[model samples]
Target: MQNFSKALLSWFDVHGRHDLPWQQDKTPYRVWVSEIMLQQTQVQTVIPYYERFMTSFPTLQALAEADQESVLAHWAGLGYYARGRNLHKAAQTILQQHQGEFPSDFEAIVALPGIGRSTAGAILSIALQQRYPILDGNVKRVLSRYFAVEGWPGEKTVEAQLWSQAQMLTPLARFDDYTQAIMDLGATLCTRSKPRCDACPVAHGCAALAQGRVAEFPFSKPKKTLPVRRASFLMMLNQQRQLWLTRRPSPGIWGGLWSLPQFESREDLIAALNPSMQTTEDSPASLVKWEEFRHTFSHYHLQIEPHRLDRVQEAPAEWQGQWHDLDKAAQLGLPAPVKKLVEQLEKEDGQNG
Candidate 1:
């Protein structure tokens, strides 16, 4: 066994997390779901989501049979809606192509909608006991510091180097435990900030620790100011306290999720509500402009100005949306901001009543 893997395994045997929900079943489906959820998200945050999701669809076949909205509703607060959408698509694909079986082959697994190189490796190693190297965020951080690798890990060259190191360090035996051990090492001791080097099993050989630059390895992405974009969300509420919501088109931000009617500007929103600006009593003259808030995406900042239109009898003819009770609307597959907004509005409505 490689010294690195041996040390990691020793530590894992003594201190690694063994009781995680996904660890309990150790099935490919469970491991795949857990891996996908863990992408760019903390384990603590994913625990409840994972448990709820497992309850909703315990088996790959069950997930395959579920609707996209139902699957996404289970993933509403997890962010990265595309992961949820792709997961649902992958499950359906497996059902159709693999007869509801999680593919055992690496290439076949990677071909799935959301499974990438690292995720595929993890699923195979942890669930199938296959000997494959993973280069997930946690692994990258661990390997980068171990080798004192310099450069943003996102760069192709840097990532390739890390992959090679990960491949070299992965041992021939106990592949499952080794896979989980390295991830635990990163998540627990070799953390992004304030790493516990003293407790790190392989700290003796960590190049970054030797060089006194543990934080500098796995260099950050080149800084770029995230551009800010503005939009107006039209919260059209009717007399029954029902809000109009439209499903966003797929393959984009908040894709396949329900959201409030959105326009490029407040004028466009007003024009939609009162196209002719006639001075009639029910011309939506009392449009209430709510305070604007910012919702940051991975690439940009969305400055959202919200407008509330009340006492409307009907939705705009052009908007093909449904009017849902505020509480009921929160139950649908909604974007995080939209879900929070719905809950906030619902709470205020209750107080007012």
Candidate 2:
């Protein structure tokens, strides 16, 4: 275990990432934001988003004071809207309870929304220079292979074993560097596929590599068929060329983001556009059904059918939102699919013009 940490630190001194945006100031707030964004996201993918977010809300107090809509707008297309929401809530919590200071206590930090055990550990070790073991996805892969950990890492028992191994392997000195070093090793060398075992610093002691089962360790979760869902996004445009957009309700998919009005099917959309109680004077002049496309989530697939209603007089009484220019709507916090649709509409408008 001592040699494990020593070898990793030695390797890190030469090869570990040192110039990441979050690594510059190395504050708890910066690390917290980076850790949350890094969840289920690659470091390279997070860089630009993180830089933009920092520019918008540079401090915990700023994040707390900002509106959820603006916060989510910054997080648009990052996926996982809940993280952005929770981050805002947690910042407000800190402002109210912790006097706007990012909590340093381990228990207090984890209590904040979206700050789990692993994320808390990472912030403590990396930014605060505390001695704590982090077991993020990258570290889990590294430890699982190094110790030949079996069973899916998502399983509680398997995760516990990995946590124990992580605690034991964490060194007393330079734990911060060791933490970053191990994560770098997993990300760069012991990758999920075609792992660069030949260049791994700790490959000499990797149980999975020694036993010719490097790929077999860190077993994947049992497979299940992902169910598909269908949706119809209404692209209702007025004669003025402004599109009708609505904010999705919170505590659901794409929560806190502005999106095209969605319905279950074209029938539902048609019914809404031409409600039984409506007069012909309020009806849309033209209705066009665009092709359907698929937008996938982790748990399910959304088969999105887009419908465009042109030269609308007014939105249905049941729909609650505003109408905005297509280009301006695209600038709002929209789901990826909705954003694509907005861009497509913009392109078409350009062609027509």
Candidate 3:
């Protein structure tokens, strides 16, 4: 096991991503932030965002003290807004309860708002140099193929068996390098699609490689079809160059984020808009632009149609719509699709004027 660990680490020292910003200083805070950001996100995609986020919220106190809007603003382009919210909440917990320091104990780390066992293990092993086994997708693939574990890893019994194997193989000395090496090996060699067994450092010992089943050991369950949902967004603009936006409820998709008014259907939108449009008797409101866009979530797809109203008598529903300069709205924390809609509307308005 020590020789295997040494060989893996030797390979990692030369080939692994040693220059990543997060790897520069493997503090608990930095590792925690990077791990949380890396959830369901690729490392390449997270690099620039991670650097910018660390700059903005350099310390746990900074993150905990940050307003939800500011935190969401930094995390705007990053999907999974819930992670940002959880990060902020967890920071607050650490500040209030743990004196603004990340917990060193594995169990305490897992007890944080969004840190699970795998994430906790990652932090413990990488930052604290503790021997904790992680069962992330990459590790699962590498271990399952090396040991030829059977059944879909998502199943409880199968996952338990693989985890037991993982614990047995985790070395005590140089645990951090070994942990990262296996993850890197799985990500770069034992990939989900076409595993590069020839390039694997531990290929000689891989049972799946010998059996020509490298891609079959880490079995997956069948995927379900994502349901499609429909919604309507009203892009209301006033003469002051400000757009009307609303804060989403604190739960569900895009929760606690500011966005355009969304309705479940065209009828609901019409019913909601009619009374408000009727109250303002200066001029009749007409739809200046209509466009449809789609945003895909993990379990569903949202098909949204945007109805832009150029002129309106008064703002509806106590929205207190502010008149922001076009450039300022770009900096505000609007969702990516909403930002695109706003840009399109601004371009159209510029052309008309």
lDDT of each: 0.88, 0.89, 0.81
Model 1 error, position 215 (Å): 2.2
* lDDT tens per residue, model 2, 1-353: 89999989999999999999998999999989999999999999999999999999999999999999999998998999879988998899899999998889899999887789999999999999988999989999999999999888988899999999999999998867888898899899999999999999998899999999998968988787466789998898877899999999998999999999888766556657755323246653667788999999999999999988777777877778999998788889999999999999999998998
Report the alpha-carbon TM-score of model 1 versus the true structure. 0.65
Per-model root-mean-square deviation over C-alphas: 14.1, 14.0, 14.1
Least lDDT summed over 10 consecutive residues: which range in candidate 3? Answer: 274-283
Q: For model 3, which pairs clash?
A: none
> Lowest-lDDT window of 10 residues in candidate 1?
275-284
Candidate 1: segments with Cα more than 4 A from true spot: 224-353
Model 3 agreement with the true structure over 254-350: per-residue lDDT tens digits: 7766788887766456657756553235666766437677898888889988887766656765554445566467677888888888788788778
lDDT of 1 by residue, 102-150 (tens): 9999999998887899999999999999999999888999989999998
Worst ten in a row by lDDT for model 2: 275-284
- Of 1 and 3, the candidate ranking higher by TM-score: 1
